[model samples]
Target: MTITLHHLRYSRSTRIIWLLEELDIGYSIVEHHRDETTNRSQDDLFAIHPLGKAPAVDVDGRVMMESGAIIEYLIETHGAGKLGVAPGEAERSAYLEWMQFTEGTLAMPVLLTMLGPRFGGLDKLPLLQGFVGGEVTKLLDYVDAHLEGREFLLESGFTGADINMEYLLELINLTGMLDQRPNAKSYLERLMARDAYKRAIEIGGPLVKLPG
Candidate 1:
């Protein structure tokens, strides 16, 4: 299958690149840069999808958007049952839960945390920050607790669900939240150390590491 990935530096799209590497498939990358002043995606992305988002993948000329959807599709279509658990598998339910959890439950508050300070100074955004902080703490605490005594999200091993999760965890880490969550911290470090992840960094550029 032909895959063309529209990648944005330091964005969630990096997860897609990482998974493609883990799958060991041939794909091309169309790199996009954030605006210097606004730090938002460029207009070039609109040509790829209506949302004009990064990680808009063109597979066999059919465009796919949303990082989670793209990750799952690639796993099902090209992963050869490597990073994903097929139907009737032991951990399939858990796999699906974590996959949806990244975007469905976790992304909003993480995004608000990052974008809050930008709209207003930290001092002025106290109420907003307070609520967002609580939500982030609660969610990550659950993740960290789940990760205790486990290497990856699943009992089996590293899977596409972990790749789906890495982007948000990295952003949360930049917020200084991971410092108190030992299991999550170790988990992120382990993910970053993977050879496939290292190669993805080389291709997509490292995650920005700057707080939103």
Candidate 2:
């Protein structure tokens, strides 16, 4: 049976679609439209995910949710010796390290800062916003420094770790914060150069809104 990805357009789900393309796997895409009136995902889509979140998948006979978890599962199952390091390889530890760092250390702060305005406008909550911004900047700088002499996040080639990092880096760029680091800028360019990423964009490009 084909894998069925229930995804929302222009969201983090793009990473999953991109990873699948990178793996050269065939999967069916199920588009879920958000309801502007209810400000929720369509009812039918809600049934598949209680939180009504996107990037969920029906892999074979099993159901899964969350962008990170889905990518991990795909890499472990489909990537194996291809897009990731093998089990006993010395780089495997570092591979997992960057993966966790991307989500836990890097993304957490960036997301908190983004939510600052919604919770309480950054101006109204200066202290909280400052803390979050400080953390985000720290993580960005860490990544930039780490990439100074490196071509990829792990191993000698692009791996699932890079895929995960790409999503976070794109978000950083969107927030106009990536230009502060030259290494980050160069890394983003290399990621954009991948043929799989290019094809993934073509497949999912309609959903991507280019910045004016």
Candidate 3:
């Protein structure tokens, strides 16, 4: 299969890059740059997928979007028994939960919390800020507690779930949100240290820059 990854620098697509390196697959990348003024995706991505999102993979000719789906597909098709928790496996439920949690539950508030200032500082939207803040706290606390004694999301080490969850954790970490969650902080540290992740950073650029 000819695999082509449409990658956006500093976006969640880096997760796919890291996973591809981990899987040791031969694939090519079609790099896309964000619009400087808007910081939104450029027209190059629009030609690949209708939504013009990064992390879209062209497998042999069919385009696939959605990071979670792409991650799951890559694992099932190309993973070679690596980075996946099989059906009926002991950690299957936890694996699926954490894998989906990044986008399904954590994305809205996390994105709003990070990008809310672009619209207006959270101060300007007090109620929305309050709701988003509450959700962020609740979700972070849950993940932190889950990571207390675990090295990865599941008892089995280093699955796709980690790839799914760690990208969001990296964003939060950059904003200093992981400090209070020691377990999560430690887990993030461990994940960032992986060679595949380092390669992803080198290939795709850092996951957003630190505030000046």
Candidates sorted by TM-score, best first? 3, 1, 2
Candidate 2's displacement at residue 132, Å, is: 0.7
lDDT by residue (1-212, candidate 2, tens digit) is 46988877666677888899988888988877767554357777778878778778998878888766788788878885777776798898888788778777887887676556556667787787788888888889888998888888864778888888887787668677888898888999899888888887777653344547
TM-scores for all candidates: the values are 0.94, 0.88, 0.97
On the 0 to 100 scale, the lDDT of residue 47 in model 1 is: 70
Candidate 2, residue 151: lDDT: 88
Query: Model 3: what TM-score?
Result: 0.97
Shift of residue 51 alpha carbon in model 3, Å: 0.3
Q: After superposing candidate 1 on the true structure, give the runs of residues whose Cα lies further than 4 Å from its correct spot.
A: 209-212
lDDT of 3: 0.90
| Candidate 1 C-alpha lDDT tens digits along 1-212 | 79999999988889989999999999999998888888887789877788878889999999988887898899999988799989999999999999999999999998888777678754587887788889988999999999999999999999999998998888878879899999999999999999999999999888774537
Clashing pairs in 3: none
TM-score of 1: 0.94
Per-candidate local distance difference test = 0.90, 0.78, 0.90
- Model 2, residue pairs in steric clash: none
Clashing pairs in 1: none
Candidate 3: segments with Cα more than 4 A from true spot: none
